[model samples]
Target: MTTSAPEPVAHGVGRVRVPMPPGTGLPFSNAYLIDDGDGRVHVVDPGSPTAEARAVLEAAIGDTEVGSIVITHLHADHAGGAAALRARTGAPVLLHERERDALGRIAIGVVPPDLEAWGVPEDRRPELLAAAVVPTAPAATLADQVVEGALGDAQLLDIPGRRVRVIGTPGHTDGHLCLHDEEADLLFTGDHILPTVNSGLGLGGPTDTNPIADYLASLDRAAELDTGTLRALPGHEDPFTGVRERCAALAAHHLRRTEEVAASSGATVWEVASTLTWTGGWDALAGFTLLSALRQTAQHRELVSRRRGL
Candidate 1:
């Protein structure tokens, strides 16, 4: 039996959302193929489902060889197919060095347990934790330093006829990176800014610092870019216009969530999560909802600490 291929949306230099069936109850996460119309193709964030995603990717490439695979972060929905795609295409997988160790921890099954302490009911924790484990390996690492094989803040990649700039927009994940094509006025945003929903920014640890602060800074940075007729090819949504507006909306939404958590007065992350009305049903979105609450709590704490100089 032959399955139909995932539909591809043509953007400036390539296509996005090479499909695999939607799983984990979320809408389809996008997989982007960036080619200069040459035989060389760079696939970004090849989304989940090892076998089916690979088949769709192979179909997308047709006879063209995959030049490289660049991961925006270590999230399962984004990087789950890296190893499989690497083996199939004989292509090196690239990830930011800061995230390399985290990916290793994920591969070795060392990620911290879900924040059950915050009040997620016992019955729901297992599935959410299981889903988080799938993506965490790097075949190759993008170096740390800006010079000497490292990606600079807005450095243009040396791809012939393709002007892709690497923009370091950390926060959703510490090592998250977005690609901006100045010539195309397009941004391949991986979970930094989505069209419909605010991306979750979980707290890694106490000393790990406030991700919301970083996320806000990243939003500010994104706003400063030349966004004329901007089209954002996000990790989960269709390529849409109004990149800055969406970023502002997400920032405002998170700020409001943080305020609400703060006003709740000593409420735990799970308590805040349970109180709020999320878009999707709890059973379907329990995983993300709980994480979002944790993130909001962390942001609230950060705001309080700043007020007292603690």
Candidate 2:
């Protein structure tokens, strides 16, 4: 497989577009390689764990030492290759503790009753139930991967000449993190805030808190980045400027969903979701995709109800 070469983003930042598995909606996931100018590089979000992608990454680094592997979250598309990369590079792996917890839950798999709660029809239930049992065993899951260090919010990384701050933006996943290069005024936004597409909340795993609420708060947290000269290097799209505007747009997108959910007339989650508009049309969605839509619809309805005391 011929892999694409890394594109230079800035003085030391490089973007590697990792190809996703076939049929996945997106074209590719972006993995950023940060060279600290010390003959060592840090790999951020080593996209999918495919031999081609790994080869491309290995070739890009050449003889440079990979000192650290930082995961923005535990989602397979983003953190899937961390373990493989760590094994090859011997680099210390770091991620938010909460991301580890979510991975743990994924290992356990979703239960049938939990699927039942989504109000899916009996005929459609089996597909979702089957999805709970991840085809590959638990050991292959991202959460089960080794972690050399745990990150905390506002903690400064000791990367040479780089003042990288770990911003805990937990809405896309319970432990999603964004790396802020304070010196360069760059924000490495994993799945938390993408350049396009309203990233789904609670997709990481089941959470104790309302994901919609967490997602909104996370958006506000992302908005704190001073926009004077900030550029966003997102996980899935091209590098973009105007971080503040993008964050606000994400927030407004969710607000519209909340209003739609609140106004929808439905006795069940499925009914409410069917009434609302989906990108591919509600009826066109089926299987796990439909399940995700219903799940998100229910969550937004819950949030709106809580806010209005309805």
Candidate 3:
């Protein structure tokens, strides 16, 4: 009873959205095809490889060469098809150095025990411990340093005639990045500032140094950008404007959720998430949503502790 994949819709400047198959747990992660006006096409976040998505990619590019594949982060849904796409198109895959390490952890199913070891409280240890056992790994390794090193703030990525500035937006994932086209004022927000829902701030492993704080700061950084005619193409949902508003809404949502968690003196992460009022259904989306809630709680606790000098 597999659902069909959504059709790819062509956008201006040779960009197209190849939607992944539905009911795959991941709701529509888009594979963007950015034509460089030359014969080369730059694909961002090929998403999980599926027969349908591959077909869409082939159709979009046609005879145009796939210059390179750039990954937003190492999340499986985003980077799963990197290896396959590269192999298919003979295109070199690029990623942040930190993301390469994160990809390695995903490959081995090693969830870093840092969250529990560092800031997670003793009473909440049981639930955190259970979550730590869950494994989410990448399918393959991205061999080369696509963008050299960490793209701090912004770095120009020149592909044929198209130039995209790589902006480091690290709240969703430690090494998460977004592609900004200064000429077009378009930002390829890889799960950073989404249109529908805010990106999740996942556990960065057991050794993460205040990830929630880092994420909040990252959001602020994104909000500070002087964007004009701002159009953001997110990993999920349609492209839209108001990037700053979306980031602020996400921050506020987490802040309120954190306050709620704090108000419940004895509430565990699971309890808090279960009791929380969310927009989407709680069945198939539970794993991702719950992880987001837990990460939010973790960030909230850390912020409170810092304020109190705990």
Rank ordering of all candidates by lDDT, starting from the highest: 2, 3, 1
Clashing pairs in 2: none
Between the candidate structures 1 and 3, which one is better when assessed by TM-score?
1
Q: What is the alpha-carbon lDDT for the whole of candidate 2?
A: 0.78
Instruction: State which candidate has the highest TM-score.
Output: 2
Clashes of 2: 0
Q: How much does each candidate deviate from the true structure in C-alpha RMSD?
A: 4.5, 2.5, 5.1
lDDT of each: 0.65, 0.78, 0.65
Give the 10-residue window scoring lowest on summed lDDT in candidate 1: 139-148
Per-residue alpha-carbon lDDT of candidate 2 for residues 27-99, written as tens digits (9 for 90 to 100): 7888888888586788898878778767767766677788788989876678778878888878877888787
Off by over 4 Å in 1: 1-12, 20-22, 104-152, 203-207, 281-285
After superposition, candidate 3 runs with Cα above 4 Å error: 1-12, 24-27, 104-109, 112-135, 143-153, 203-207, 226-228, 271-275, 280-285
TM-score of each: 0.80, 0.92, 0.79
lDDT of 3: 0.65
TM-score of 1: 0.80
Clashing pairs in 1: none
Instruction: Score residue 90 of candidate 3 by CA lDDT.
Output: 81
Q: Which ten residues in a row have the lowest lDDT in candidate 2?
A: 131-140
RMSD of candidate 3 to the truth, in angstroms, is 5.1
